[model samples]
Target: MKHLIALATALTLAAASVLFSAANAEANERYGKQKVVYHINYDGGQDDKKYRGARRNIQNHSNAVGAENMDIKVVLHGNGLGLLSQAKTNEALRGQVLELKGQNVAMHVCNNTLKGRKISYENDLFDVFAEDIVPSGVAELSHLQLQGYTYIKP
Candidate 1:
């Protein structure tokens, strides 16, 4: 009787462990393949609340979902480009943006903004790739949504 009871208890424990691990694996998978985009199109210059809010939102969202498990991209155009400009070129904001990028967050700028504003990527921005620049900001947002990326208007 004692041996049988011990065996049953051990089996139950093993079963519980297996179930718990499986559940955890599934939960991780829920965000593992998720694609997200954060939009930054405000024009408040350096003192813009919405611009700051958008940055905070992205940080919070990445924190909530586990940045490593998420495929995240932030699209900047019009005034949203200001955030990157401040973060990249400005000595004060550079560290913050670099830390975010360290967590696999990619920032894409709009080519139209560059052309419209006559901004030179080579002289103006940091950490942006030519390939990452899309033709139009709004159009890129639409295209990303079509590609199944969840858009957050932060």
Candidate 2:
């Protein structure tokens, strides 16, 4: 009985693995290699639910396209900077940012917003670097679109 149960579990695991691989292959075939930019320009709300939803959307997009086959950028400016600011003290938001980063999704902060708001990227935002700063968020979006990146506002 024990052997039978163990065999059933192993077979189920193998079947799940095969199904997952097939799904990934199908997604790759349908989407191919993609360049995508997600724009975040609104305040995520008092509880940051909107930001959380945006993160979820990005994760879904990455999962569907396969991170290896996608170049993803997130452009934040205006009230969108709230995403990073909230993440500083919000563990869940921080984890989401780190997970997206792990998937090679670049988070680009607008230099104009930072300067206008007097916010320091090093001290105010979460895990931002000099390379992640763009002169203007709108310009970055336009540049990315010109470069063949599909724009998504979430």
Candidate 3:
């Protein structure tokens, strides 16, 4: 009777462990495969509360879902292009942007904004490549949504 009871207890513990591990893995997978976009269009400088909040939000999202397990993009246009402009002069803000980029977050700028603002990526922005310039910010947002990316406005 003692032997049988011990065997049953051992089996039960093993089963519980397996079930817990599987559930944990599934939870990770759910977050890991998510595609999300962080949209910024406000016309505030880097010191603005709203702008800072948006950056915090992006970092929080990446923290919740492991950055490597997610596809994250930040669409910058309109006043949002301020980040690029500030990055040219602000070392702290530039460091943060670089950190996010290092974690695989793609930061895009609108070409229309560049034209309207008379800003050149080469002269005004830091780290933005020509390829990262989209024709229109709103249109790019719409296209990304169509491609199943969840949009977040911070």
TM-score, per-candidate, Cα-based: 0.73, 0.98, 0.79
Which tens-of-lDDT digit does each residue in 70-108 have in candidate 2? 899999999999999989999999999999999999999
Best by TM-score: 2
What 10-residue stretch in candidate 3 is worst by lDDT? 43-52
- lDDT over C-alpha atoms for residue 89 of model 3: 85
Candidates' RMSD to native: 7.6, 0.7, 7.5
- Cα displacement (angstroms), candidate 1, residue 50, comes to 3.3
> Which candidate number has the best lDDT?
2
Error of 2 at 62 (Å): 0.7
Local lDDT at 100 for model 1: 77
- lDDT at residue 119 of model 3 (Cα atoms): 88
How far off is residue 47 in model 1, in Å?
3.5
Runs off by more than 4 Å, candidate 1: 1-32, 44-48
- In candidate 2, list every pair of residues with a backbone clash: none
Candidate 3 lDDT over 92-138, as tens digits, reads 77888888898889988999999998989888988999889999899
Which scores greater on lDDT, model 2 or model 3?
2
